[model samples]
Target chain A: MRAAVYHGPRDVRVEDVPEPELDGPDDAIVRVTHTAVCGSDLWFYRGESDRDPGSTVGHEPMGIVEAVGEDVRSVAPGDRVFAPFKISCGSCEFCRTGLHTSCVESDGWGGDNGGAQGEKVRCPNADGTLVRVPDRYADDEDALRSLLPLTDVMGTGHHAIVSAGVDAGDTCVVVGDGAVGLCAVLAAHRRGASQIVAVGHHEDRLALAEEFGATDVVAERGEAAIDRVRELTGGGASHVAECVGAASSMEAAVEVCRPGGTVGYVGVPHGLDGGLDLFSFFGDNVTLRGGVAPVRAYAEELMADVLQGTLDPAPVFTKTVDLEHIEDGYRAMDEREAIKVLVEV
Target chain B: MRAAVYHGPRDVRVEDVPEPELDGPDDAIVRVTHTAVCGSDLWFYRGESDRDPGSTVGHEPMGIVEAVGEDVRSVAPGDRVFAPFKISCGSCEFCRTGLHTSCVESDGWGGDNGGAQGEKVRCPNADGTLVRVPDRYADDEDALRSLLPLTDVMGTGHHAIVSAGVDAGDTCVVVGDGAVGLCAVLAAHRRGASQIVAVGHHEDRLALAEEFGATDVVAERGEAAIDRVRELTGGGASHVAECVGAASSMEAAVEVCRPGGTVGYVGVPHGLDGGLDLFSFFGDNVTLRGGVAPVRAYAEELMADVLQGTLDPAPVFTKTVDLEHIEDGYRAMDEREAIKVLVEV
Candidate 1:
């Protein structure tokens, strides 16, 4: 199997790796058809992540199930499926309550099976962790591109919107113009937010945010961004989705949020040593929620939206490349030449 | 008029101060009939608060409206009223949304009233900030004692419960057995929690917690306390009311919360130089909310419950003293001789 392997800083290579096999009764082997290079993956390519060398990279994938073990009841051979980043047992107390991110019987960060940036991969806890794609769009390339993001980024953006208690007619702000931020703008739009403000500096990404349903865009940073959001919303946004996990992004999320509003953040915290300012956080009465999203919980419904053609999140993928040229996808994203890169396996 | 004046740490003197006078058409003068020494007030008494010298020091009070300026429509002279610690103009964007603590047109800390421990307070934004006590409880000493806490402590406790999204039948844990923590126990009880665990070391305060409706008490600190709470509730509590503002207290609140549970905290953050740990906080998926509560927003409803005799919060006042012995009231609370001290004028 050919997979993308991490070597050192700015180095990801496409090389032959050992194929994954079913080790448990609940396991299934998925033939990867579509996957993407995430913003977080850049952290590792740039030597920022502590991930070891020679490890398979990538956490987002959607494909057809080529094989299933005896105990896998929910999904079977020949079925199209989407696997979330985290695998859960589905029966744990946390998993039962829709908090699958904290499931007790699951391995986070693609344990044992490695990652999805490969031709084929093994999936554990198959029944509880995988969602079957509808038959109608199973062969549709455009629909596949739209549905692939539901495994991670789009689901994460949806989690932020829901965690912030964003209701219809709300004024929501999306901080950071990454792929996840663009997805959040779409999520807020579909969730009935009357006004969506996109705050980011990149003109190309912000332009895509507008196409994804952003009602306003503020190309500013830090306090200036907050001021622009406040101006757009008249006072401040009722809900803010902080997609950049930096400390400054968290501070700006708090600053531009209305007094009783909430800020849902899903960006993986990278270099934030000091925590958020509790004094100001307290005074404003802003609610904070959103960690690793419970992607499996929302995958079925969101994928349905894609299949039904109600949501088209494919515009986020500005470039697509062959699996053999996977390093180009990484370089394109790292150099800010692309908003997101789709890798066709 | 005589009021409590702060000269330095542990030095509170009841001396003659100039009578309060209304300076705005929206102002009203409140002749304080009852005031209390708060847990936060101890910060100033212990030289921990940066309050300037000679400032009047107190924040919880309920009294009769002695005079009202021309534009004070919601309250009038001779009307009994309760003033939340922070005064807010009800017309502001935050106020209209029930977040009066962040009102745009008012000072947050007592405004021009100086402090509630004084004989009379000149309340700015009186109509928006003051809640009229019902005529039935006008001269009821017991009701006055119960209602006075609604201005701060009880209201803060309620904020924690509401912020944590405590629903009926939730297993709740109150971290900190102080007045606010005990009040949180009561709030959780009133909000229909099926199981309530109070975490603290003080036997007297723990006993009071049971009286206020805590189903169990864990006389432990740090890890042991979290263990006890998990044991008491079968796993972990669905809602956590963190009434202690210390960093360790915040850590404990996060440590024991069920995945997807929330921690509502209202303690005036004092010794926490470092903020909360976002890494663990994000992983746990625990929502954090509650700052300076919009006590004025919850005051009217909570006071109604007190006046109707559905709640009896007066037992929290373990001691009472006249205005002339106000210093003794502060001393009793400072030394932990009383759970709360009421000062009658």
Candidate 2:
């Protein structure tokens, strides 16, 4: 089997790797058809993540099950499926509470050895980890792209919106213009946000955001961006989705939210440090909620939306390349030449 | 009129000040019968707050309505009323949402010039701010003391529990041993918390916490406190009410919470740098909510509880003093000699 392996910072190579086998009765082998490069992937590809060398790089993948173990009840061989980034056992207390990200038995697919970016990947706890793609649109490229994101990004964006309690007719602001942020705009739209503001400095990304249902785009950064959002939404947005894990973005999200509103942050904060103003927070009555995306919970429903054409998340994939060009895909995303790079296996 | 004036840090003087007069159609002159020295008041008295010099200080008061403006329809002259620390117009959007503390027209009763510690207080928006005391319990000192704390501390404690969504039989943890924290323990008990952990180092305060229905008291601080709470609760607390506004206390509250749990913080954050982990926050799926206590909204129900003897939050008051010795009351709280100090006007 061939897989995308991380060697060093900014260095990825397509090399031969041992094929994954069913080690447990609940395991399933999936032949990768399509996989997308994520912003989080850049964290390790650029040597920012603590991930070791030669680790399996991708978590987002959609394909047909090549084989399933005896205990795998729902999914069988030849069934199309999407696997969430964080694999859970589906029976843990945390999983029962819809907190699969913190599931005690969950594992990140690619830790030390390259996992999902390979042609063939093994999924543990198959019953709880895989969502079958609807038969009618299983092979549709756009539908496939949309379904891939549901495994992580789109589901994460929905989590932010839902956790923030965004209601129909509420004004929402999305901080960051990455794939997740763009998805948040769409999520807010689906949840009936009357006005949505996308704050970012990139013209291309902002344009893409506008297409995804951002009512206004502010090119400003930091406090200025907050001011623009406030101006765009009368006083301030009732809910803000902070997609960038940077400190400045978090501050801006909290600052721009209206009193009694909420700030739902999805970005994994990298070296974030700042004291939240309890006085201001108390005075304003703001709520903050964030964490890893609850992708498994939303995988089934999000795939349905993609199949029905009610949502088109594929526009976020700026480029698509062959599996052998996976390194260049990582480079394209790292260099900001593409919003997202899709690899066809 | 005589009022407690903050001349400088640790320098409070009982000085003759002009009696308050009606400034608006909804204004009223209340002869303060009982005024409590709050922990927040000590913030300004100790030069910790950015309060202006010569400012009158005190936000918690239960008094008689000596005079009422033409627009004051809810309470008549001679009516015994307990006014929430924050004065707000009832019709604003924030007030309508039940967040009276964030009301656009809301203002604290004690600050640069607004002082409820004075013999007479000019309560703005009197009709919306004052809650008439039940006549049956008008002379009940225990009930009145409990009602007095409801004007701020008790109400803030209730706000934390409510915001955290504490349900019957849920496990709860109260951080901080201040008046508000102890009150939160009582509030959690009243709300049906099956297991409550009160985390604080002070033995006296901790004992009071146990009296208020805290199932256990963890005298350990920081990470150790979190460990104790987790050990006692079998996992992590389902709900956490942060009554101490310091960064460490807030962190402990977040750390001890279960993945899907909520942390309600009512403590005013003092001087502290960045401490909240936003990245880990998303992964944990913790909800953070707090701010000013919405005392006005809960006054009626809490007062009814006080009158009915179902809840007695007055044991928290460990000291009583005449209005002339009000400075001593602040000193006692500042020195940790008293959990709460009551000043009779």
| Candidate with maximal lDDT | 1
DockQ of 1: 0.73
* lDDT by residue for model 2 (B1-345), tens: 789988898999899887778887898888898988989887887788777778888888788888888988998888888888889888888877788888788877764325888888888888888888967776777678877888888998999898888889988999999999999999999999999899999998999999999999999877788888999988888699989888778778888888878899888777555655454446688888877778888888888788888998888789999889998999999999988998899
Q: Candidate 2: misplaced stretches above 4 Å?
A: A222-224, A275-280, B111-113, B135-140
lDDT of 1 at B141: 76
DockQ for candidate 2? 0.67
**Prediction 1: B-chain TM-score:** 0.97
Steric clash pairs (candidate 1) = none
Candidate 2 lDDT tens digits, A1-345? 889888889888989988888888999999999888889999888788776777767998789998999999989998998888888888899888778888888887774323778898888888988888867777777678777888778888888788778889988999889988989988998888988898987999999999999999999876777787888888887788988877777778878889988988788877465634344556688888767887887777777777778887888889998889998999899999999888899
